[model samples]
Target: MNKKLTLSLDDQVIRKAKAYAKINNVSISQLVETYLGEVINDDEPKLTGVVAELAGIIPDQEYDKMEYLQNKFS
Candidate 1:
């Protein structure tokens, strides 16, 4: 069974979220639920560890693009 919850956000944020949902063919509530679920999942940590180990095996320059994107987003 699923529980109902209420959340408040700025109008502009909601507009952007709704636009993304429409582009992805999903409801805003579904997108929020999926993101919350991802945040609470333990398997994601395991996958992250594996990916991080693999990433460490790559040369530093090979990851410069990823670092640049991360900095851009951050």
Candidate 2:
């Protein structure tokens, strides 16, 4: 089941959001709903547990060998 709701947004924000919606092949309303749902029902406790698992595992230390040259060239 779903319900309708209305809200106000700045014109520029709406315009950009619409473009984002189009690029992603979804309606503006859907994008808004997804964003709102994520924010309102955020699982902070679960996220903390995931972060805890990565305690000392520094991701991609191999990138340091390139001296971050990939960013400059690519």
lDDT of 2: 0.81
Candidate 1 lDDT over 38-72, as tens digits, reads: 88875745446667668656566655778878999
Model 1 lDDT, full chain set: 0.84
- Give me the candidate number with maximum lDDT: 1
Q: What is the lDDT for 57 in model 2?
A: 78
Over 4 Å off, model 2: 45-74
Error of 2 at 58 (Å): 1.3
- Backbone clash numbers for all candidates listed: 0, 0
Poorly placed runs, candidate 1 (over 4 Å): 42-74
- Compared with the true structure, what per-residue lDDT tens digits does model 2 show for residues 1-74? 88898889999999999899989999988998898888889877344576788866776555574766777788
